[model samples]
Target: MIKVKGLTRAYGSFIAVDDISFECRPGTVTGFLGPNGAGKTTTMRVMVGLTPATHGDVTIGGLHYRDIPNPGRHVGVLLDASAQHAGRTGREVLEIGARTMGLPGVRVDEMLDLVSLDGREAKRRVRNYSLGMRQRLGIAHALLGDPSVLILDEPANGLDPAGIRWMRGLLKGYADQGGTVFLSSHLLHEVEQIADEMILIGNGRIVARGTRDELLRDATGGVFTTLVTALDNHQLAEALTERGLVVHQAGEGLRVTAEPVDVGRIAADKQIVLTDLRAGHEGGLEDLFLELTAETQRDVLPNDMSADEVRA
Candidate 1:
């Protein structure tokens, strides 16, 4: 298990991570999500000892990462897929890692196969490998030790849809077999699909953390928004307001803070002809993510802005 308590990282006057605390337990995948520069990478680096924490602590299995013997054998990490030696072949990369961990040579073949990097592909120089292939090679190296805990950053960045699906299943199976997986990504849908729990961060602090359903429940506050359109839109709106439901004009319909069934019942009682009625969570987790991180998200330039103004 990974435990972080009041973890904070500072660079002079600028604070990168601020007093954040969370846990990644065994047999579960914890997704650390945030917009760019929200401190997700800094926190992960501190956890693995690449960066020093200005305050607080992080421990893996009750021991700091630096204190662990041959930490890679216990905690597999792939912070940057491109950080591997560019002069070596993909096979050479895993061979070095396996040798450092005192694993047999056959372990290299196993990992290459596990990540689906064929013998021919493995022999290719790291510099010649595409971003997607580099990612695969990096994953192969991370799993080469068969560690109990894996920490990856944006593992799906260069993967295609099929590769992403493969990775999702691979991590799911790893956690199912009692390993801990702590990965960070900005890909909302992929994380929503595979993460057992999620930690959302913005402006160097955690905004929310919980299971997908739990976060959605908290965001909606037990009141789901329903979109409805009726032949007599004015009558339907009045009836919904009379029933104590908050209603808003949405296009040619009404958006209400009530369930579809409840809205249907209200329309039925008012003898209104309904044209449409459905829950308004079509955006799913993406909506909640954007809402919580709105302040941190970068503003798009106005379309009318001149090129010189944009550069300026």
Candidate 2:
């Protein structure tokens, strides 16, 4: 439903977004992930024409957002959580959002209810709302137009665990109904739970993009961890080594990286009498994301520090 082709944006001599391309399919929630200053916001701005790209283009339903009539009705954007007027009540803020999109004023109230902000706080001024409340308000505004595409940056910021879960369900439901939802977030655990695919950027370039499973497979080569509990760890290790498999001692159990069935057969052949046999997999999205972005930072930063410093 959304396509970005070689999108590039530069600020003076520094490139805020490098040549990058990706697709957000319908009936799926594609996550936009990057470390700080990785051009996630810049890319989103360019996509919506909020910030002009130096090169390349992005389109929704095959038409540039700028070329579409009432683009607000076709795409709902929640980039800045503090974009609303501080003086406006929550309901009023949503009303303005609805009206701005040429939608009905009732949509404001309906969205407020839809986001579960109905009775108690609708009349309260936005300035009086807590950070979590403001997040909900931002989501309410994004949903006001009932647009088919949603581009949200940090929609879960300041939300409690329950609120985050609700947001996840809401986005999932939207995509399940064939809507396109592109969410940008720094929370790896959250993205791991909800996103069907992920696009990870660093130094303004897309370093990785694929399904979570695909990324794990690509970065880790289908590696699996086998934990073997046996009385003679040395014999089991020798048996596995004789089979040309790598083995390492981990606590009382020997950790072997090999096929699950192969490890079991080796233990049987060696008469290891395994009491506990467990299987594991390598790096999750969090691990792959870290590895990719870390390498990018090391290559891009002015000084040769570490990833933690770049993040700091």
Candidate 3:
């Protein structure tokens, strides 16, 4: 398990991570999420002892990363996929790591094959590998030692759809076999599918952390939005309102604060000539993610719309 309490990292007078506390438990995948400059990378760096924490502590199984013996055998980390020697082949990189970790040279072939890097690809120089291939090589390096815990940042950044699915299954199986996986990524959909728990950070602080369902429940405020559209859209809106359901204009349709079944039945009884009908999420992670982290974002749109406006 990984434990962090009151963790902070500062550079000169600039603070990158601020008093964040969380845990990545054994046998679970914890997704660390945030936008650019939200401190996700900094926190991971601190966890692996690449950057010293200005205050507080982060430990893996009750020991600081620096204190761990032959740390790669205990905690695998891949903060940057391109940090390897560009002139070296993928096989050579893994060979060095395997030797450093005291693993048999045969493990090199095993890892390359496990990550689906064929003999031809393995022999290619790291500089010639595309971003996706580099990512695969990096993951292979992380898993080469078969450590108890894995900490990776942006591991899915350059993967294709199939590659992403492959990675998801690999990590899921690893966790099922009792390994700890703490990874950070900007791929929210992938994270939503793979992560057992999630931590959201903004402006150097942890803003939210929980299972997807738990965060969605709290985000929607115990209600849901139903989208409805018909030949007579205005009439459909009125009928929904008369049924004691809150209705609001949602773009070309209407959004009702009720169940999809209720909307369907009401439309059927009213003979409203339904054109489109669907239930909004119980609470969407994307909406909550945007709402919670909007403050830390630097991008500005002249006509930026809120989640409600976008829903409309």
Candidate 4:
């Protein structure tokens, strides 16, 4: 498990990571989420001892990263995939990692194959490899030692759809085997699909942290947003309003704030002919992330700008 206590990092007076604290437990995937330059990279760097902390400390299994014997065998980290030796072959990169961890050469081939970098791909020099290939190579090396903890930054940045799916399964299986996985990624859907818990950060501070259900529950407002239509629109709208439910006209239908069960019951009671009905939770991870980090957001759609405005 990874425990961070009052972790803070500063360059002179420019504070990058505030007094933040969190834990990445074993047998689960904890997603570190934030906008660009939100101190996620700094936190991960502090975790691996790549950067000295201004205050507090991060530990892996009750010991500092540098204090751990054969740290690679205990914690695997991939801060920058492109940091690999450009002149070295893909296989060579993993070979060096395996050697440092006192692993056999066979482990290099195994990892290369595990990440689908075998044959010609593995033989190619790192400089010749594409961004996606480098990401795969970095992942292979991180897993080369079969470490108990994994720390990755933007692991899915350059992966395609299929590669992303494969990575999801790989981390899930690793966690199932009692390994800890803490990763940062901009792919909200991937994080939503794979993470057992999530930590949201903004402006160098942790704004929110919880399991998906726990966090989404707070964002959902306990109200289901539903779209429904019936044969008699005027009659249905009047009946719904009289029943004390808020309804509004929405593109050939009505957007109502009510549970699907309640809506169906009301329709059945009124003997209305329903043509369509769909219910969904209006807010999700994207919505929550935006809300928490809106002030820190650097890029945004202009309030009065659209395709029409741009063409004018």
Query: Which candidate leads the pack in lDDT?
Result: 1
- Per residue, candidate 2 scores C-alpha lDDT tens digits across 64-95 of 88898887777888998777789989988877
lDDT of each: 0.91, 0.85, 0.90, 0.89
Model 1 — TM-score against the truth?
Answer: 0.81
The alpha-carbon lDDT assigned to residue 181 of candidate 1 equals 98
Query: What is the descending TM-score order?
Result: 4, 3, 1, 2
Highest TM-score scorer? 4
Candidate 2 vs candidate 4: which has greater lDDT? 4
Write the residue-wise lDDT of candidate 3 on 1-312 in tens digits: 999999999988888999999999999999999888999999999999889999999999999999999998989899999888999999999999999999999999999998999999999999999989999999999999889999999988788989989999999999999999999986678898889999999889988899987887778886877888889988888888888999888888888898788999989888889888876783388878877888777764546677677558
lDDT of 1 by residue, 1-312 (tens): 999999989999998999999999999999999898899899989989999999999999999999999888999998999999999999999999999999999999999998999989999999999999999999998898889999999999899889999999999999999999999998788898889999999989999999987887777776688999999889998999998999999999989998789999888887899989987764757778888887788864566997799789
What clash pairs does model 3 have? 251-312
Of 1 and 4, the candidate ranking higher by TM-score: 4
Ranking by lDDT: 1, 3, 4, 2
How well is each residue in 16-100 modelled by candidate 4, as lDDT tens digits?
A: 9999999999999999999898899999998988899999989999999999999888888999999999999998888888888
Model 1 sits at a Cα RMSD from the real structure of 5.4
Looking at model 1, the pairs that clash are none
The alpha-carbon lDDT assigned to residue 224 of candidate 1 equals 80
Clash counts per candidate, in order, are 0, 0, 1, 0
